[model samples]
Target: MLMGSCKSLKKVNTVSIRTTKPRKISPEAQNLYKRLQETTKKGYAFGHQDATAYGIGWKNDGTLFKTDVHEITGQHPAVHGFDIGHLELEWEYNLDTVPFALIQDQIKKIHQKGGIVTVSWHASNPISGEDSWNRRGKPIKKLLPGRRLHRTYKTWLATIASFFNDIKDDQGRPIPIIFRPFHEMNKPWFWWGKGKCSADEYKMLWRETVDLLTHEFSVDQLLFAYSPDAFDNREAYLEYYPGDDVVDILGMDLYQHWTAKSFSKNLNDGLKVIAQLGKEKQKLYALTESGLEKVRISDWWTKVIDQQLAHSGITWALFWRNARKSHHFVSYPGHKSATDFMHLAQKDYVLFLDDIVPIEVSSEAQ
Candidate 1:
């Protein structure tokens, strides 16, 4: 019992030592952080993962920019999510088969329209040479500074940094990105999950990644978000937290895996935890990834998601990708939940691209 108390006190001191400010951030990124902080007071932004790259049955062939969210409600999501899986291998396309060039183009377009872009990386395992889900061995230790895969991992980060550095605007200014890497670390499926590595190792991995991108590579137009899967308590949620200085956003990825009652209870509970932590740390919070698969519950948007977020103090809520009939999150035009989703979109507290005021930065800053 005494040892546990001592460790807890140490963690508290670590948290207190760090500041909430982003490290070496660009001017536009600073503006974005301020805007998101202020916008949270009014309402939470709505986000969709890979919304413009592809949809239920169509892929953007570099000609038209469309999303199921816009098709249903005539408004785009305020936040847009993209992934850079397989980027470490210097692949031309991500694991989702979306071209890297397309992702960059879409990011520029989103930034031009004053929408937020959040990116996640599902990097392949360096030890086993397998995909991210391969948890055959403890790879985190090997990916660290002195191990055999350390050089390989640094090369991967270099590629990622180059990609981030290339995502600039019309005037050649770096666009701000909410970079979410090693997400859902509380879950066991991924290689970097709870049982795969010790909490200290995870924290080190996060800190080193941020340090490399910000200080080593000079990619500063980023706001790092540390997101874990749902948890029953605050201790479990924060067990793998890197630090406030490294993380700009405190987020959780939740999904309605069971009954709506259970989902609502869990959402409410999780939001309370982050909200309190955000206040203590002076950091932004968000529902980083969430959805009810297939929209099986017709009123899920209005009754479950929106209801939970209604004064939840979250900065944004991002639904997962819209892949196909059996594997989609948001409602399409003719789906059963489409009308209910539209109703949710119309809420005064729900923000879409049309509802948000465009963030303006000086040309000199650019």
Candidate 2:
């Protein structure tokens, strides 16, 4: 399917691809990075978190692949976001109760359909054995090399590595993923967040994790993304950055926590910071996670979200999931914002699944 579709689209130039850890990545991963960079030149892609595993009033029963976005727009998102929160504990199901096996299946399907996949890790707190939000202690240092919890952290990473390695196409090629771990680190809610660990400690944690997965575990089908919560300025956003060589994508997770006006301002400011940094570092960037919960405002999608993202240069903007009645992000069929969302989907600058043309890579490039 990908090969047949590619004949109609321009082929991705694989020469001198600019990805972090280039030597350690697979050919497919390198091509994906190049393809994403090419995509940003045209427009930013639309993404939805956990779109297929479950959605408003429905969950994947290991049978059909469905999403509220698809049900409304008649297409899936260009990018699919999934969380591996509980996979660190060897749990069959993630913290959101989506099965790991099911997540793998959905990832493969999305890739086969020429959509992108980005995975975030809400890893459990190693120090307290609690959820990812547990800030009981400074666990970053302990999770470093030769520390008390280092072995345990390695085991968790091994589990994650295995899961990533298992995401293969029907032809047995590994699917490239934008691996986003310890996201929103500018906030203090998670154990690895700002106040819980020093910036150096956080950088070490990131570098070590990348090293372990790329060199130690030989999991090469990944492009690491560094995302922080909304920040006041560029300096604040880069406080805990590992380095250019360890991060392929620079991202931010800002939502409509308050007024739409404030959300728009923050979105613009955050995108400016990343756009500058991405240009300087030659890396891709995205609004890794976002959206107003419930999408109460009818014109929020077009007036607010799309307006901010116009020529933003970010690769994609992923809305959060549609969990239940009061907790959804995107609109459903009968919701107030559904029509506006449809209009947003129709916009030329916004790339949905149907709008994207798969970039063709020659076997030699792979």
Model 2 steric clash pairs: none
Candidate 2 minimal-lDDT segment of 10 residues: 1-10
Q: For residues 258-342, could you state the per-residue lDDT of candidate 1 as single tens digits?
A: 9999988988999999999988888889999999999999988888887899889899999999989999999998999999999
Off by over 4 Å in 1: 1-22, 359-366
Provide the global lDDT of candidate 1 against the true structure.
0.86
Instruction: State the local distance difference test value for candidate 2.
Output: 0.85
Clashing pairs in 1: none
**Residue 281's lDDT in candidate 2:** 78
Superposed by TM-score, candidate 1 places the C-alpha of residue 92 at a distance from the truth, in angstroms, of: 1.1
lDDT of 2 by residue, 1-366 (tens): 011010111112321111224336688888888788778877999999999988878888889878899888897899999999989999999999999999999998888888999999999998888999989989987987777999998898898889999889888988999999999988989999988877777877787798789877889888888899999998999988877767789999998989999989999999999999888877888999998988989999889988899888899999999989799999998999999999988877788876665655554454
Name the best candidate (by lDDT): 1
lDDT of each: 0.86, 0.85
